[model samples]
Target: MEEIKLEKGDFRKNIAVAGLGLIGGSCTKALRRTKTGKIFGIDIDSGVLDKAAGCGAIDDGAVDAQAILQKSDIVIIALYPRETIEFIKDNAGHFKPGTIITDTCGIKEPIIEAAIKYLPKNVEFVGGHPMAGNEFQGFDAASPELFFDTNYIITPHDRNSGEGIRVIERLAALIGCRRVTRVEARAHDRIMSLVSQLPHIVAVSFANLAVGEKDMSVFMGRSFMDVTRVSVLNRELWTQILEMNNSNIIDRIEDMIDILQKVKNALSEQDKNSLQILFDNAVKGKRMCLY
Candidate 1:
């Protein structure tokens, strides 16, 4: 791992992305515009590859993971947390030595742990989570501009080369990310468990609570709707994510349960002062947020 300095001209490199769903498709589109080298879309779905290719999002498409792994200087895997691990386990040996790899998976520690276990020493597998995407699924919903103004988080393994991480940061910037922040893998997972996974759980739970009310949607207001919008989720993908960051997520949920019990007790006791305190604290906490 010698010092690898990236220049504006060095932005052109053979890049392959696994999975062409929202994040992958968006990356394909963005990279196709910015990178001078070949952009390959690797996936099992020929239809998706065709769609991406037809729209100029990818230079070519391949179903063979090894083919892409062997050819690309960089690989961005946009698969589920577990699937990303399995993919690396199966294909990491096939990656050209010195090739840099990254992912768009939500949880980090598990993926980073699994990657380090399986990836070849010469290959750089930097655990990454591009902080973007919406409640949408599939390539059709992908916008090339999706990464614009969004944060990208990268957790480089201690075993990873310094140069590889720098390349990833520059690559993130080239993809239109407003900021790229590096965090320890465990810390990244811990924060994502509270900020990202817990919200989805809350949104889905909120929707689940409305089952008894058949016309709950009829009276839906902005606040409830806004909070539950992510309830329209890709459950399978999220199931993997929740499990990957299980311990951290469970800790946060336990904290939530504790606070909720306090709120419930205040309501049951008809304690206006206690209820007002909770409401005021929540407002103050929220006001501290940037957006």
Candidate 2:
């Protein structure tokens, strides 16, 4: 891990973002808005490439990542966790020497392991997860402002150089992230299981209750809608994420079930005091963690 310095006030580097989905498209759009280097967009869909190019979000577009990888100083692999790993394994040799590759994958441990096993020694991999997004998917929902005022997490392993970490931090800031936090890869997954993955599971489970009900929408309120917003998820993508982080997610799910059981017990017993205490504890928890 040698120190490589970027010129002050001019850190423009050739950036390639592989995948033109929501996060990838947003990254390309933000980099373009900031005039940060030559940006190349890559996706399997030619229509997505055309859309991104038409919107001026990318300087160039391509289906093949080989040429882009060979020229890019920084490559953002914004794909699903397993797909991201496969992409690295499939194109390990194409990366430019000294290229810094970062990913926007939800789970980090597997991706980091894949990089360690498959990536060229000269190439560096930084694990990143932007703490932002809506219940939307694909390029059409992408926005340059998606990262604004959001937190970005970067998990660097022993293989990463200080210079590569700094470059990623700068890129996060350039894309309007309000804060950039460094965390261990496993620890990041643990936290995400509770704060992120668990919520989606809860939403999906709750939303599923409407499946057999007739005129369900007529009874839905803002509270139900708010709680279920994330239930409209990309099923395949979430299946991959949840499976990759299953251990952590399972623990959180168990905790969630225990809490829900407590509420159910209190209501069944008609114990008003117990219910009020539960509500009070929830209020305190929200204030402590979220406020």
Q: Roughly what TM-score does model 2 have, to 2 decimal places? A: 0.93
Tens-digit lDDT track for model 1 on 1-291? 132234767877899999999999999988877845889999989999999999998888888888777779999999887789888998967999889999999888888888888887888888888999999988998888999988889897789787888889888888888888889988898988878988999999999998898888689899999889899789889888877788999999998999999999999999999999999999998987545
Stretches of candidate 2 exceeding 4 Å from the true structure: 1-8
- Model 2 residue 245 lDDT score: 96
Alpha carbon lDDT of residue 4, candidate 2?
A: 29
Q: State TM-scores per candidate.
A: 0.92, 0.93
lDDT for model 2 comes to 0.90
lDDT of each: 0.87, 0.90
lDDT of 1: 0.87
For candidate 2, write residues 1-291 as lDDT tens digits: 222233555547899999999999999988887656689988999999999999999989889999778779999999988889999999999999999999998899999999999998999999999998999889999999999989899998999888788889888888888888889999999999998999898899888998998998889899989889999788888999989999999999999999989999999999999999999998998998763
| Candidate 1 regions with alpha-carbon error over 4 angstroms | 1-7, 270-272
